[model samples]
Target: MSDSEPRMIEILRILSAHDKPIGSKLIAVELREKGFNLGERAVRYHMQVLDEKGYTERKGYSGRVITELGRDKLEKGLVYDQVDFVYSKFEEMIYLTDFNYMTQKGNVVVNTSTIYDESSINILKKIIESGLSVSPYINLNEDKSEGKIEVTTLCGTTIDGILLNEGISSQPQYGGLLKIEDYKPIRFEELISYKKTSLTPLDAFSSPNRTSVLDVIETGDGIIPANFRLIPGVGRKRTLDIINKLDHIGIGGVIGISDEGRDILGIPVPEGMVGIAIVGGITPFRAVQENGEDIDIKIAEEIRNFNTLSPITTKITYHLKPVEHDIQPKISFLLSKSWNLIQQVNFDIEKRKGDIVANVSYLKRDDLDETLNIMESLYNDNPKYINPYYKVLDHPSDDDKVGIATICSLSIDGILINNGVICNPKYGGLLELTEPPLFIELISYNGSTVDPHKIFIAKDMTRITREAGSKKILASFKEIPYISRDYAVDLLDTLDKIGLSIYKISKPRELTYNAKADNYNFGIVAGSGLNSIAAVREKGIDIHVKAIEKLMPFEKMDRL
Candidate 1:
């Protein structure tokens, strides 16, 4: 690549980041932020050259746009390689959770050029057939940025590494797998109306196409408004027909919903039948063969009773999966384009016995560099441990990157991408409202386990709950991920609305991520656990803080 190629790639990156067109002046501003010293005039010259080469299209007063060719270059890792990239903006974390969890248990390491390569389908089947667990490795290069001289395999690796090693590689990316007939796409508007009809997230999700181990029984009549086809479609008859056909194949279920949810969607209403809008979410049962082999899907449920929804953002889940492919390129592209943004984020790393728990006060999709540093530090510091600790990265972001990095990092177990404060970038981002965090964990690589008690999350949870009593404490305010601060004013106001005592919890080490749902579940234990008062009475405040600290360093414990 030519020397100017890097600068051109940067321009293309900026253009692709935002949905709207951009101008040379704006591009110049971004370049300056990225440590470039040039003025807008220099950017204009570059833009002109890029325009001639069909890399960008000038949109009159709006600005320039990256063309398909430019996007191809960026996606293909020409001048702007996805490997060793940084990011500030990102898509939802749930996708990251899916990518990481899906690949972590495999024995083969399949490397796909892009997320769309059809080879993943074959690779997955091969894993099943060979009965070998596999891990998909992205980006072949190592991150020597942390001062390591050897070119080790960080997380992202080139396809050549796959071909050279025992790993597998497909031909250069042609396109995504042809539309798999497994799922039938329903109208978006219909689904939206269905959600409004249910009024509950649990009831709403039950209507989607999914698979699980056990079928949920409904509390009332199982019919949901979405279960029936609507508008330009047939109604109950179609849904019944589909359900019957699916059941005939062994997928047994009446109306699609949990027994309790049945009443929520259909039974509780006094009005006439709301009818089914769609008939789906049934997983055809696989009868065990003579060898007793069968695909047994395990169903999971969200624990909300003990979980507290707080601050304005309330919840950020990287736990959800099966995101649409059309929106995923940005999930990967987000970090590569917003490298500077990643540097602006903050996080802390701690040891949980044999695992590393990283609690990020705030994060975004592009800040991957910092996450890698933490993971490598954990791995290097404890060489005695076979694989070190089961690595965990937890962060909140609008578009997420830290967890994505940790998820893709070497020797990691699983991760939950949390969304922090999210504000429209077009609106100048949190303005002057962002608050100085209660604390900032300096990113440190190469450190021993922070706390010996930080072992299996269950043991820690048991200790916390036993010590905790009836007083529930919620300490937080609404704030954007890295831009603005969420004020304690909201927290105080909330406490006033509901009578409650204040108990401060101290945060000393890295907030640990113990459960697959641990990242979010810890918030529940801290915010709404009935054991809070019992723990206070049993252990007093100092010990209480230490007890909780074993699981996580509670920043607002002092406030409580």
Candidate 2:
């Protein structure tokens, strides 16, 4: 599929998606609304070709409807996706992205990457403004309560929503906006921009991963503090560029950008921390000079000179990814590949004065290759080990294939444990009643999304919990599921390298779980879900019909 696939696929999609047939004029209108310039005649011609090709059908008076064949073509040709990219320097980027992190108490800390090129801001601004005007879905926050209905552009939005358009466009670099030789870089702000996703040079961190940058304040004369130099990504050039831009605008805010960037200025934090960041890619301390104020730079240079003389310690935590096929060979190859890739690109995979050692354990590897491949194809991005979704899967069931397929279906990294069958309320004598089997395969590596690798039992239940996992994990007063282990064994093996620790303690006082309620379902509790409905049905409540009867009142009401 080339650049034209989007329009052609969209035509098939809109036609097949509609309940009734749509005319060529209507299809052209839909395409134009999504920023395509195709006219009615061109659309009609495409429709005729599609009919000739058995991809669409045309009734005498009615217009076009997509055939099963056409739908298949559309599905294969165009894929829908949402993804992120990290920009390093001009035309220098690799496959990487960040996830929305949260604090232990559960607040959203945005995951963002830098655009390196200052000139890209001009491109970003243009895209944002234009997309804001054209994209009817992304920037709308309708004040439905207003007396006078005046449609206008939206200014603010909550953080969870994506700012990209729902429609397909004619743009070649539709995923993001970028300019490169023999390639076009996607500027995401224009392609699928979000209101909460937009930021300027003034945006900076307040706490490591606590506050939102959009909440930052402005100084006088529409200028805001942009002291962005402090961040590792900003470096010196971005700081200078930001300062020079601010100087031209003249500030009413901080006389210049402050260390807070736009995070804080004259503004006071209302208080309380909200989000958390993973801080992966752990490494050992090393000496390096960084630019700063003249005196600070001198001190940093001197410190580096002194630091290099000090003996260094090396640390390596191999993720030791497992394979469905060739586990040993893959592990060997991964280690060898790591070493080879290091020396091959002169990446300096090692430092001085440290011997690399291995810590082998009961291993379970999470290879998110299939999901990564699908996403890469959809976004037309490069394929690597980059994953945005991770999991903590277990093989509690005899169905190891289900267990394997469950984790293989995520967008990130994960753990795989063969920890027997999961427990439900109804039946459980060994695995659940006595103590849940939490035998973990303590493999090492880092990535996103900690989906459980084991079964939640039923496929429906796993599906539901997986949806809930995406809801929120860490938060204030957070209580994760109970673990059966005595030590912080899994946490120490996995997250310890990154300096994160889990406080897994035992019950100070324990009560023997003697089978006290034999009739928990009937005499005492009505049970958990549909069974409860069945119980109520036994009580002559007719809950099955009652539930639908309750909705009749709402369905009866018409226009307000």
Best by TM-score: 2
lDDT of each: 0.27, 0.23
Off by over 4 Å in 1: 86-560
Model 2, C-alpha of 480: deviation from truth (Å): 46
TM-score (C-alpha, index-matched) for candidate 1:
0.21
Tens digit per residue, CA lDDT, model 1, 145-175: 5422111011111111222222221111100
| Clashes (candidate 1) | 65
Give a tens-digit lDDT track for model 2, residues 152-231.
Answer: 11111101111011111111110111111111111111111111111111111110111111111111111111110112
Output the lDDT of residue 264, model 1: 22
Clashes of each: 65, 38
Model 2 clashes, total count: 38
